[model samples]
Target: MFIPFQPLRTSSLSKKAPTSVGRVVAITGGSGFIGGHLLDALIADDTVSRIYVMDIAPTTRWCEKVTFVYTNLARDVQFEPQQKIDVVYHLAAVSREPGFEWNEYFDINYEGTRRLLKWASKLDIKNIVFTSTGMVFKAGPFHRAPSEVPSADTAYGISKALAEEALSGWQQSKRGRHVAVVRPGAVFGRGCGGNFVNLHRALRLGTFAYIGGPDTVKSCIYVKDLVALMRGAAELKGWHVLHGTYPQAPTIGEICNAFCKVFGWTRVIPTVPLNLALRAAAPLQMLNELGFSNPVHKRRVEKLHYSTDIDGSGLLELNLAPTHSLVEAIQDWRDECAPADPH
Candidate 1:
């Protein structure tokens, strides 16, 4: 018996991931920025046999060479995964926006994941790669290392925690499924559509602002590195939790300085504190979740106060090279905003 709770499908992919060529893998949210990269990476690898992209968004790119399945994880729909997916990359979630109603958060983030796992179990899938966020950590000082336990206070975090717990329970059943949870810090890059986009807007127009205190540090990862981590997890897993962060995380101030140096600017202003931002964001975020086009209160700002970090040693062990350096990424961002070089 399969319980399908959520019925929404989105294709989330990244930029640098190679194409799928020989291996068969099913990725929820394949159309997304990072997920797209996963699809591209898989398709490019001749070792990969086939690639399945499950999501609501139609495959704007590479629709011919790949298997595109339209379905939502938030619902219990009976659709077959592309032929024998040895690896399932679960990247779909609902926290990108702010101020969602409690139930919507549960349905999309929490129950959505539960249904995905159930579907995978039914298929007897072997390896599962879950893309998680650093939001699972409670309000506290930065973590120098990944802990044995998991935690989350808000609906988004709570939902991911519940999913992890469910997966862990399944693992204890001595099932063949190998699950890996990757917690990434502030993920940033070109073409990214989340929190960092706002930062990019600031750089483009010179209105970027920092949240929380100057001491607050946010762990970060280049999207390419994250894709590498996902590939590693796809290859191996044992109820593991790895942080997809660079060994060195940058504080808001440090990030600001990097941008400033790139733009030859003088200063970056500090935004409101996390708590206040949440309060102010709540009303607006809720309004936006009502399906408004641009709501100011985004769900991501809820915990933008303190710095966040997760250990990268596990990812390092998998032999993944870091993609863009802070200097390079920042420079690229600045160049993009400046008037085109009149060459």
Candidate 2:
């Protein structure tokens, strides 16, 4: 019997993770940042016998158990599994924004998902975990709230949302197949040059300055926590979908201040009003719309003024806990990716 997705609510322990012991797993895009971390975790698990990595290229991080299979979802890539894959983590997608063409985005992101689903149908892979972005939710006053509706305001987000729809359709068409779509918000950590990477670099070099009041709330999840979420998703039965973010999202100002304290930077970052910043970046925004690459594009500037507050209640309802703290995770990132100057 197939259970349709419902808004997550408190359920009994019957909804707990099914045993993954002695399961053979496959991860698409396992060469990427989050996938690599997940691969590491899977390798460490004694229960998992073999790990299959399906990507365009091989992962730089080498392990004895991990077998890298060269597969491109864009093409007619053949997926002949040596062993039946009990769980497959679909993490591959074109996440780049602004620079990519519409066709390219849809082809890689949306179509890639379709190809995977087709392969899954052939292999009868019941458990699948797909990584979608929090950007699928439209930006508005609900930034500080849980995003209930699945809508995309950007090309990248639209592509992911469509991929999610494809997954939903696949589940509906079959029985005993479980799918989990995890919408992670601003995932950051070692080896991840996400939104926080630029912020960290600028702050380290004393060039990080906020144009608008840095009070915009942004939800974030550490990569390790994301891995945990993926593990939970793979084990959970039925079709589940939820946002993966910090329970209480911190504001931009709060994030900056925390970093300052951590790095021992005594200087206060400057901030201007939203209107002033928008006025200054208007010309740049116009140029960007005309196909020019503008660093201060209107969309980029708008993100700073708005809130992306995420609700983690869904995760709680599933009884999955994110162990890492934001500051601690950021500190780890700095130590590995960007070390502080001991001046």
Candidate 3:
């Protein structure tokens, strides 16, 4: 089950202030996993007067402070905010999910950003915080830095890189225009049904095993920390590209151990050679394509072995530190999943 996207009971931001002195913010993809967390933070912030959410779908949770607008970024839709938007948090993008064609990624990830910039330009909005991915760098056994030239290989990565270029051009077009590009590593938390969720499920089912070895670094950041970084990045002046990940990169083994510890599981996780695992997962991939809902995928198996040791030292320069450690993050996630208290 996924965690519900609701307003956070407590946050780092100050208590709500009167609408007169708060900033009016707009967010794209506010219904998504990361965007939901950002929404929670903004809702708790006293400095934020109102929030306008632009997306095709409505958010599960709603409040008086937030207004949902049915705006499709991929298409040329009429989006005229009633109030002047102070800041825009651009988090909408097509991810590398199954069945998405290259054109879909190009339309939503690349062209959508261009369209958003056009709208922002028209509204005279100066601040924009965009959520890019660490996938913009070539995936391999090397540490990737924010400053290093992006050598993106995947379609999703290429589209985001183009979007970033568009944002850079937008920033350079006018004086006092600020854009903060946040490239985050694997972001995992309660609502994320991605790699970490898959790992947890496989472990609970007694089907998880270390691919190749136990030492491959899997650079990651918690969802809350990532949104916090995005908020902090928006505060900085000028164009800034920041890498969002923990200071210490945790290995796959360490991640698995932390999950086990959180759930109080004692079974030892086995290791399988990469080649053998790939061969085993090939049939499962075929079965999945043939309408069988197989949990195992060849791509996921390969991703487990590849190390993504991204450098997130840029966080230190900006005086932004992640609130939770790996173990702490996993434990917090577990707590979120617990049954609600009955009166």
For each candidate, what is the lDDT? 0.69, 0.78, 0.83
Error of 3 at 40 (Å): 1.1
TM-score (all chains, Cα) for each model: 0.80, 0.86, 0.91
- Best model per lDDT: 3
User: Which segments of candidate 3 are over 4 A away from where they belong?
Assistant: 1-19, 340-343
Backbone atom clashes (below 3 Å) for every candidate = 59, 1, 0
What local lDDT score does residue 95 receive in model 1, on the 0 to 100 scale?
63
Error of 1 at 172 (Å): 2.9
Give the runs in model 2 whose Cα sits over 4 Å from its true position.
1-21, 143-147, 282-296, 338-343
For each candidate in turn, give its C-alpha RMSD to the true structure in angstroms. Answer: 7.4, 9.5, 5.4
| Consecutive 10-residue window with the lowest summed lDDT within model 1 | 1-10
For TM-score, candidate 1 versus 2, the one ahead is: 2
Q: Is candidate 2 or candidate 3 better by TM-score?
A: 3
Return the lDDT, model 3, position 202. Answer: 77
The CA-based lDDT of model 1 is what?
0.69
Error of 2 at 187 (Å): 1.0
lDDT of 3 by residue, 150-173 (tens): 888778889999999999999999
